[model samples]
Target: MPKKDNFDEARLAEAIKIALAQKKPNIAKIAREFDVSRTTLSDRVKKAITPTTPTESRRNALTSYQERALVAWIHQMCNWNLPPTRQDRQVGKNWAYSFMARIPAHINLAPVKQKTKELRRI
Candidate 1:
């Protein structure tokens, strides 16, 4: 595997400043000097004064503790010489749906409809 390169904007900024002061801010030359692509240097220049916030993403249905509790329940059930059957699995899934619903909607969960579809497919 090739070595991973980390962006060092602070170091690049220092080099760019010197080039700018000399009235010779060449993207290709700066990129070559910095051992990076010209596109990377151009992208740095394109960025605004203010750093942007990271994009938001969907979250899990349950918190770590809650998820662990559910997993533990399943494990206990299996160890008790009683693995859940199809119906039992459906019940467990329904219980999970209800559990997810009791929490904030921002806590994303797989819809119950998804489970229903899988059941039908099976």
Candidate 2:
């Protein structure tokens, strides 16, 4: 049997962008239009999109101002109580860090680690 459709960050983002551009961030509308469940569509859109450590290095990247804005926006939009520290901003730009925090915690909001060997491999 074919594996179930696992929505990717890119697709979710596209859907969100399309919805927003159309002046409709409505979960139900987007879900129905996209033929995806409302919960799944919401989860995908809310999930952070970042690159792994090595990918970050390979990209010769630095924490851009835009990235910081994204972190701030994510905090506000998600109602994350965590402060936007410099370290948090830096780590939030990385996929591993974002992905780690994406794992549902009790609070649904927490500052992810800024550094990790395993994350570098990811």
Candidate 3:
């Protein structure tokens, strides 16, 4: 299964821009030109619609900004050749694992180490 969003958000944004630039915006014309939904463009122009996806979850212990800051601090620790295993003051072990999962760039090192050890054994 291919993992990618099907929605043409950039085109929709352009339609919204053109609609707003007009003195008397024509939602229907702009929608047709940009191949976007008339109702969606109109709603966006009027600021009547909210995002489909909620950015922050209610169950999260820390905010997104805080998580980013924590990641940056961890990266800095790594740059200084220091171990980055002491971040459980405000979060739990599960939170740490989930945080790693959420970040696509973070690689799980356990499996890699195991593979390396097995190769060394062979």
Candidate 4:
């Protein structure tokens, strides 16, 4: 397997800043040239440009309530009862959603729908 490239936040931030300072930010072109995904580039730009609110910081950074709710939401949407793993336990739910969100929507696994007949049989 090829070695994975380390994604340094600082480096990404600088690249995003340069792109933004240009007359017009061509996000797709920048992503193709840099060999980074558009979503990754967009995330870096959002982080570098958007000002964080106190409530957002407090809620997203320091709380588990939101994370748990997000986890529950994802589980429901995906129709999986799979429990969170050790890494999930370590980072909490907010990180989980953040990680999941990085995956392209087109690449998602097939949704697992509940079987009403199976439930009735049980």
> What is the Å distance of residue 49 in model 2 from its true position?
9.6
Cα lDDT tens digits, model 4, 1-122, are 11337655665666687788987788888766666667888877777678876653443443566655655666665655443343335456566567566445664644455546467667
Q: How should the candidates be ordered by TM-score, best one leading?
A: 3, 4, 1, 2
Higher lDDT: candidate 2 or 3? Answer: 3
Candidate 2 TM-score versus the reference:
0.27
> Lowest summed-lDDT stretch of 10 residues in model 4?
81-90
- lDDT per prediction? 0.56, 0.54, 0.71, 0.62
RMSD for each model, in Å, please? 13.0, 19.3, 8.9, 15.6
User: RMSD in angstroms, candidate 2?
Assistant: 19.3
lDDT per residue, candidate 2, 13-95, as tens digits?
Answer: 66766665654468787766766567766665555333334433334233545555555565674454444444344433576
- CA displacement after TM-score superposition, residue 77 of candidate 2 (Å): 50
User: Which candidate leads in lDDT?
Assistant: 3
* Model 2 lDDT on a 0 to 1 scale: 0.54
What is the lDDT for 4 in model 1?
Answer: 27
lDDT of 1 at 37: 54
The 10-residue segment with the lowest total lDDT in model 1 = 108-117
- Across 46-81, the per-residue lDDT of candidate 3 in tens digits comes to 883344755688688778888778778776666665
TM-score of 3: 0.40
Tell me the TM-score of each prediction against the true structure. Answer: 0.31, 0.27, 0.40, 0.35
Residue 14 miss distance in model 2 (angstroms): 3.9
Indicate the worst ten consecutive residues by lDDT in candidate 2. Answer: 48-57
